[model samples]
Target: MPNWLLPEFIADVLPSEARKMEDLRRKILDEFRSYGYELVIPPMLEYLESLLTGVGQDTEIYTFKLIDQLSGRTMGIRADMTTQVARIDAHLLNRNTVTRLCYAGSILHTRPSGLQATREPLQIGAEIFGYPGIEADAEIQSLALASLKAAGISGVCLDLSHVGVLKALIASDPLAQIFEAQLFDLLETKDMPGLIELTKGFHEDTRTALLALPSMYGDVEILKEAKKILPDTEGIAKALAELEYLAGQAECDRVTIDLADMHGYHYHSGVMFAAYVPGLPNAIARGGRYDHVAEAFGRSRPATGFSMDLRELARVLPAAEKRHVILAPWSDDEKLCRKIGELRQSGEIVVYELPNSRSEHDEFVCDRFLVQEADNGDWILKTAGNE
Candidate 1:
């Protein structure tokens, strides 16, 4: 029971990684601000019912719960920040005009999101409230692209999917009566054999649509193929059109479509997107339209946004530029203190030396130092190498 021992998938961020993550957070939030997205900081936990509402059942297993000492009710440690953001928009702010909000903080999950993933993740995200048009979705996508580029992420392949298409395909009375759980498994895993067997008793079009989904991945033209293969009911056509519009608006080098992509199908009401970089097995970021996520909060608004794990991004991102540092000697001389203050005012990183301690480290390469010149009796600065 060593005190320093953290649970599996939860580890402390040492100085090096912490600095990089903070830099990423600062730069990304600045990018979000430039797009007029106001920053919001939600609490780390909430009542279970409040936290789980409209976030989709798939996320429930990831949330950790405990009895609240104050209220004597079950409270959930947030596994995702998006639901909190939605509640803020609908209940707290209650604004009629479209609102763009962004947030960055840590979320604790009960299970790892992926292989070798951490249960404690620093999540950064943005959300748009009150706008249902494709334009809002486009803005969010463009912002995501810009933020990724700011973080030096390149060679990204943006994968687009619309949950509406799936909903439309299976909305028929006969198809609705079938075992949805089996179909979900087949579609999610792309189990063609199981899908074919399961769809044997389905209608001709339904069977054809279910079987065609797995192969629907690839290129922007997948939308055209989907329109022909999948039924147009339940807003499928509108959904495809929106995806196509976003593809054009995104202006990324590579954009692909997939009709079978159902990662957030349960609560993701419209177009869903995930950004993938070459060689990465999972998407670097993901988001989409979830219109009624705020319904339980008393207002149903059109919302679209994206969130990425800052810890994950820091791993993939290039190191941030460290400030040029000047290591000053451990002295209480008035002239020395004045010089250090002046340098700091001029945007210089002058680390005042501590008693019996080293000021320079791997990141803080002591480029310059302060010294007392015996000849003139005044403290002067000198290069570390020269000294």
Candidate 2:
């Protein structure tokens, strides 16, 4: 066999892990359904152009592309489900009104340089299109919180920031263009000292506000503190007000406002947020308002959405013992086979095996075992541990 069996970042989801992931996926989908967000099973592969329409070129580099022989056009595997749903909403659904769509699928991407982010990630999320307001942001955040609760995650911190606020702060000074890149880098790394050093050239007030940005995290109180420090730019004020309003509306107990949290995705316009749980260094789920993504696709609709990485959630979930029942027939009885088939059809995990050697009927390597009687009678069921 050739040495190269699989690529570096991608790997198989074996039966055990796959089963657990499917269970988590179903639970999340059920939660989304409860919220009236209709499920959408988008195609695994799409046209390269359609997929690359809204999301920037940096994200596009991660996609795996190929030429379609039948259509003689470039096709690419979906690297993100958000853009795919946007295309569906704009072109397929074609409604100017509000729509809630949810999806669960695998998104393929190349491994980032010096990072171990999985190449194939299982994403489950919802998109809200055509809603325009901070109210929409609050609703999405609420839904995301509820979804996490439903998945049995507790003590979640909702890290909220406004993309517009950050952009406005950068736009205020003539030197903004020169310092924008470094400022973004500082925010990404949560480096307060580096930010303080970099902003030394700015006025004292602006410099102090910029320095304090990284630590402006906590409840609604932090929002007030941010307002006091940040220059009274109209955009920044609006963004702060929106965050405060969102905090009031959100019912979650653990909310943190990180004014400096800036993730560089072009689609995120208004507010961006991520859900963090214990044991996971990065966010288990993230989403924000991207009103312009639909417009980039030529439909010009406002949209906001978030996705939970199933793999990350699985890592944090407590190990659940699998329940199994085994079926063993001493004789090749047709009726026994029929019964086993019925149980299997009813969603029971049954394993049919040859008759056991022990006198005990359930002496088998499973949670439970079944045996057929020589006489025409009901089958005997026994717990494996008891036997």
Candidate 3:
């Protein structure tokens, strides 16, 4: 392989896309800050045990692990930062009141998540720790929408789900609990045939509710249909009610519900949500309640948050506008050097044209150039075309 060639599902971010990603990161972080979320920077790697605790346990397959040279222990590059932030809250901060935290960083996955997905994703998100109310979940969903809006992505649809729904259905039947793992897979994939084959021995009501879950996706009305058709267990009722309240509270172009969405079944404790835009088939942002994560760190705290890949978010946006700048000739002349320094200090991009060479930039346009006035030798700005 060529030394310059990157591995599959990994590639360089060129100037144009890099600028877009940076600008989006700043705007989204600013939005989080405005919501009173303090920024936190977690390390990229940690002891394997620390990285795979609680909500992060499901990400072990995605993490890249290595043997620590000095300690002779295994260390893994984080595939997700949610649990790390939880560690920070549980061990480092250890405050009694509600705490809000936000982070932006690169996470390494052993493999790509999808056909077009990258192995290295720039993850940006916010989390609220030490609050157990449903309002925290609602706030997280709202902040996710706000972050996307800050990135200028509109026509967004918020899809809500709760693990409690399926958990309730399974818990009510001994047979369902026996085959819980299989049932989870079948439900998530919406395999009607597989579900029929697997649920034959289950109680008639449990089977019916399990089968109905796959089709229980639509607008808020689906929640009503779910309450009517599914088993009338307390767990199911609570989950449905929470979904209803959140659906009603959601502010977006559209709202959707998927009772069988088991994406974060192992990680999330209660309400879970994914946000989608028009052009993307997959969700652009995903978040939910994972109140149990902090427990693995020896402190039990209610936590909720959401995160998105900055690279993927940047792809949906148009190329960043090329920066307008002033072109200047490189010289030892004291006055010209002073003028260049002044322009740079004032936040202007000034590219010096080298002797016998041309300067080129992919993300900058020299729309203006400094010219020496013939009368007094003073440097003055002139439009490139006019000159």
Candidate 4:
């Protein structure tokens, strides 16, 4: 490894990209605030046990851990912020009523999540706590769609799933955790052949429904197909109804269901969804309902939210907007300084030239400058190109 080389999957964000990311962050946060979601900033790291709450085995693998010298306990750098926010809701605030929270921060993953993913991602998200109704799921999904729109993102396709379908089946025929883990891995990969081989001993009805899941994906009609082929149980019926309602309320251009899309198997208890925009190989945003997450923090609260990488969103968005700049000389003239201050206060970027240094900045468009029409006279603004 060379001294100047960065670790694989980690890269620096230059000024232009950072500016765009910040701009979008502010816009999305403002949108969340409008919907009554107050912002909360969680620390980058926490005790290993607390951080692992409400997360799956994969999240633990993705996390980077260290020994805490202060407390002699293991600490883990956050790979995701949702569980931390849940801690705040359950242990700290302990609010019984409905509470909405939002956060923006950098999460460090042990490895890149996808082929084109980053190990360090700036995650921006919002969560609704203390709400368990299907409406809460709908609200979060709608909020995610709105955030993308606020970021100038279009052509978004939202893939929806309700783990309740599978959970219902598992409840009827409980299996050992080890066997369930194998089932989860197979479903995660959508490996139908492997799934068929593994579930060969299951009852005919259960096997048929499990097999039907992989292909029960597409538009809203998939939900209809699911109800027909899957076991006629209360959990399945309820999940199908909830997905149908959420799909209608999503307000997105396209919505579909993936029955076997149980990405958050251990972490999420209800609906799971991923949002994709055109040209992005992986989902730009993902979220779902994790009703049991709060229990890890000592109180079980119904929660739902979504998170997206600001850096990834910035990369796909249009170029950052260029700002007009007024470049002026470094001087002690009180009036000239006052005028520059006024321009800056009025939201214009004014760059002051340093004494005995380079006078030109290629980065900014210096179309205007401060000048004095005559010596000992009032300062005036003039076109730099003309003067």
Candidate 5:
């Protein structure tokens, strides 16, 4: 085999970081389990058609595709797990009602140039299928809050929005042609002036709303202010009401009203939101109602879910220290090694002794080794440095 190179955006996780990631993954999975969300392991590789069944065109562009050698057909690495779960729920599960499913895995995508985003992200999220109404939205939001707390994040700011509101405002025939691309660019830059320039010829009401978007973020009072300006848009009103409900249901102090925030995922229809931490520019978790995605896959169901980027979380988490013990066995200390193995089996970190001179023992003492003595008939364990 010829020597190959890892792509620029792709790299392997080292042991220290991997261990931290595993611990975080377990903590998140445990939280999901506590909420009665059964874990599902979807295939890392899937048929292009099946995976693309309901994923929007924008997201589809990022997926890495290739031809399958065995079947002589096209397949793609999973760019997003949510779509695969939707397919499973629609076809395999065959349930028409709500199903709570959770998952933690790596998602692959092409590394976009000039972006800090990771191509391989570790995600842990839950999907609630076949539930509709504000109640479903509130439940997902509540779960997200709980999950964030479980992951040891505090002071979380949840930015909420309705895709419907923006879609309604941009639904004009003329603007529809360039709405998506222009909106994406504007949102990413948070450029109110650019948004105004693009929507200059739009209807008065729509233009006013679009321009107000960048500043429509703040406390709940901002929602009331928005209601006064933009009256009778049921989509916006409904979104605000849902946010109100969520505010009351979740820890109100952690929730913030951000009307300007738009979901990148096209399938998101009604309420969408993202949770942010202080030091991270990108959201730690995000999800919202994507009711129409199931219909695209030949099954109609309402769904809302959120996923955390474990890699990012691990990066911000404090360094983990291991509890360790070193067993210094003598020539006749085979029994001591067995005893040390027992402690190890009980989850203690143990390092068996290597042959050593007196200087080695001095080094162990200076290093503060948790030494187990086995030279005498009776075994003793103590910190060598302390002694």
Candidate 6:
């Protein structure tokens, strides 16, 4: 293989896509900042235990582990930033009042999440800690929607779920609790045959409810049907009510319910959601209430957040227009140099034309030129190719 060949599912972002991704990153971060989410930057990697503290098997499978030379402890390249931000909130910031934090960075996964997915994803997200109400969940969901809107993605559908619904059912019966992991896997895949075989020996009501969960996905009306069929446990009731409220509060084109959605099931403690756009079958972004992560760090704060791969998002967006630039001749003249500096400071892209070379930039088009007036010798701007 050629030395320049990248690994499978990994590729370099060229100038055009990189520009779009950077622009989206800035706009989304600004949207996050506008909501008072203080930006935080965590390390690219951390101790294995710290990275895996409150995440599930999915994240564990994604993380890339390494032996740290300094401490001889296992370190993991972060596949997700949620827990790291939670650690900062629980241990570092140590704020007693409500705290809002946001982060943007690249994360490495051992394998691609989908056939078209990249192993290295640019992740950006925001979290709120110390607030345990459904209102926090609502805010996070709204922020996720707004972030997509900032990126110019439209026709979004918010898919909502709650881990508590399944948690309640499992906790209500010792038999179900014993097979919790199995049930979780089956439900995530919606493997009816497997769920049937696994739940055959359970209580009648437990088996019935477990079977109904997979089919309980649709519009918000599914919540009403869930209320009628599912066990009326306190946990299930609270989870359903929260979903209904968020569905009502969601400011998007559509809202959906998926009672059996087990994404981040082990990681999220309450309502979870994924955003879907028009073209992609997979979710564009995912988030939910994860109040358990801080507990792993010994602070026990309620946290909710969402993250998306900017590269994946950029792939769907239309290509950005080539930036317009003013071609300036490289010169030692003080006035010419000063004029170039002024244009740069004023947010114009001024490219210097080196001697014996033509201007070349893949991401920019030289539509204007800086020239000295023939009569006055004063530097001025003129349209390129006019002369």
TM-score for each candidate, following the candidate numbering: 0.95, 0.87, 0.97, 0.96, 0.86, 0.98
Report the Cα lDDT for candidate 5. 0.75
lDDT of 4 by residue, 304-376 (tens): 9999999889878987767778878898988888888888899989888788886553346778888876867
lDDT of 6 at 363: 92
lDDT of 6 by residue, 1-387 (tens): 899998988899988889899999999999999999999999998999999998888999999999999999999999999999999988899999999999999999999897588899999999999999988988999999999999999999999999999999998889999999999999999999999999988988889999999999999999999999999989999999999999999999999999998988988899999998877767899999888887878889988889999987997899999989999998998889999999999999998999989856779998999889879778999997687
lDDT tens digits by residue: candidate 1, 109-159: 998888778999899999999999888889999999999998878888899
The deviation in Å at residue 309 for candidate 4 is 1.0
Give the top-scoring candidate (lDDT).
6
Name every residue pair that clashes in candidate 1: none
Clashes in model 4: which pairs? none
TM-score of 2: 0.87
Model 2 over residues 1-387: C-alpha lDDT tens digits? 577678777777765666677888888899898988999889998889888887866668889899998998999999889988998899999987899999999988876422355788888999899888777787788889988888788878878888887788777766655888788888879887787678877766666667777778777798878877888888998999888887777666577787878774455888988888877787878999988777767898888989988877877887656565575655576777777777889887666554555332222236667865668766767776675
Q: How do all the candidates rank in terms of lDDT, highest first?
A: 6, 3, 4, 1, 2, 5
Q: Where in model 6 is the C-alpha error above 4 Å? A: none
Look at candidate 2 and give me any clashing residue pairs.
none
User: What clash pairs does model 6 have?
Assistant: none
For model 2, state the Cα shift of residue 282 in Å. Answer: 1.3
Alpha-carbon lDDT, every model: 0.86, 0.79, 0.91, 0.88, 0.75, 0.92
lDDT of 6 at 191: 99
lDDT of 5 by residue, 1-387 (tens): 446767777778876678778888888889888878988899999889988876677667878899999999999998889988888888889886679999999998776412366789987899899888788778778788887787677778887777766776666435644676777568657887788778767778777777777787887778788887764566667777877777667663466777767655466888888888877778888888888877867888888888878887876677665534455545456666676677679876555455673433211223324344447554456666467
Per-residue alpha-carbon lDDT of model 3 for 1-387, expressed as tens digits? 789998989989998899899999999999999999999999998998999899533599899999999999999999999989999999999999999999999999998876588999999999999888888988998899989988999898999999999889888899999999899889889999999999998999999999999999999999989999998889889999999999988889999999989998988999999998876666789999998887878999999999999988987888888999999988888889999999999999999998999987889999999989889988989998896
* Candidate rank order under TM-score: 6, 3, 4, 1, 2, 5
